[model samples]
Target: MTTSPTAPAYIHVLIVDDHQMVIEGVKTLLQGEADIQVAAQASNGPEALRLLPLYPEISVAILDLNMPQMSGVELSRAIHATYPQIRILALSMFHDYSSVTEVLEAGGSGYLLKNTNKAELCAAIRQVAAGHTFFSQEVGTTLLANLVIPANFDRTRDAHPAELTGREREVLQLIAREYSNSHIAKALFISERTVETHRKNILTKTNSKSVVGLIQYALRYKLIL
Candidate 1:
């Protein structure tokens, strides 16, 4: 008789925020998820850095954008520069495009507003931990609203738009329309994993480094029009 396969291990996470209440709240929300475990909590970037060595199993970090001494952007940059393996998720009250862009540019794997519900927050954490980008519904909409696409934008800088598979096109359009992976997965009747795969493929074919870049490419090529 053969033994059954072992279940996958939980992804350890570190929560970093200046506010003790915020950290506790996030920890509470994450309590019921069997696939996730909170390994530590830090009040600031330096504390987080210090705790990293103590908990080397942490695969994801949920960070607050505003903190004393070192802001979330600074912390994210520092963590990314030193520990490239830890994925970051920025949780902030700000929904502005600039703040979101800064977090992403700072090497955050995902961004979600502080008002996010527990379910969405958990989903975002899992998505980032699994190596995919996640943007809250409002955050994505705000980002698209701030973009200014030129009427005569050229698409010849990259490969032909036709090179994208049909699935990739659908995923790209939904992403431009500000749909999160879970939403796209539901709408397209596919798994969130499949949507993530399509997103990575789309980025590769378009040579886009971020979601903002991908949206610009879509507009230039009329993929969203």
Candidate 2:
């Protein structure tokens, strides 16, 4: 009996962002490639978390830092902690020296800016999935030029954990995005009662009296975008 031909392996990817248009654009770009597939798209970190379990073949995650629930940095940390084998590609607008450093330090293998072309983005996914580091060309030039600063290196070495949990930061970011508790719960796939619990804990941890105060704290500390 003749056997059927095997399909080529495709690099499964997850796109994590809060914006619909960005997701659609990336979907189109990835779909055109024969060896790649947009396995899943998430609107926020919490939603991403829920979707990740279903995509066992997902090889890379393209993350956006400015989501309503969890920022990219926190999501990177969580992914590294849980599914250590999955590669993370931080897709962000912060191609600045500090931002790139933050993503790499947080366990991301690739960093690309929003304006990167479709070819470069696909190349990046393949590169990172194969255990190579990739940075956007524009960001790479700046990064190479600035990598020699002694002070910058020292500051990166001195980084510390924020005195907040990932879930708490997720709540704070949703607040910054002007999402209500009910909305946050819906987006996060948690019940309203659970969201309220997280909110109370976030307020206590940040010492913020209310939602407005929480936003002020986040912006002052440069935690939320």
What is the C-alpha local distance difference test score of each model? 0.79, 0.73
Give per-residue CA lDDT, model 1, range 144-196, as digits (tens). 67765445446565435648877777777667544568878887888999999
Per-candidate TM-scores read 0.70, 0.62
Kindly give the number of clashing pairs for every candidate.
0, 0
Candidate 2 Cα misplacement greater than 4 A, ranges: 1-8, 149-225
lDDT for model 2: 0.73
Q: What TM-score number comes out for model 1?
A: 0.70
Residue 145 CA error for candidate 2 (Å)? 2.0
After superposition of all CA atoms, the RMSD between model 2 and the true structure is: 14.7
**RMSD to truth, every model:** 9.2, 14.7
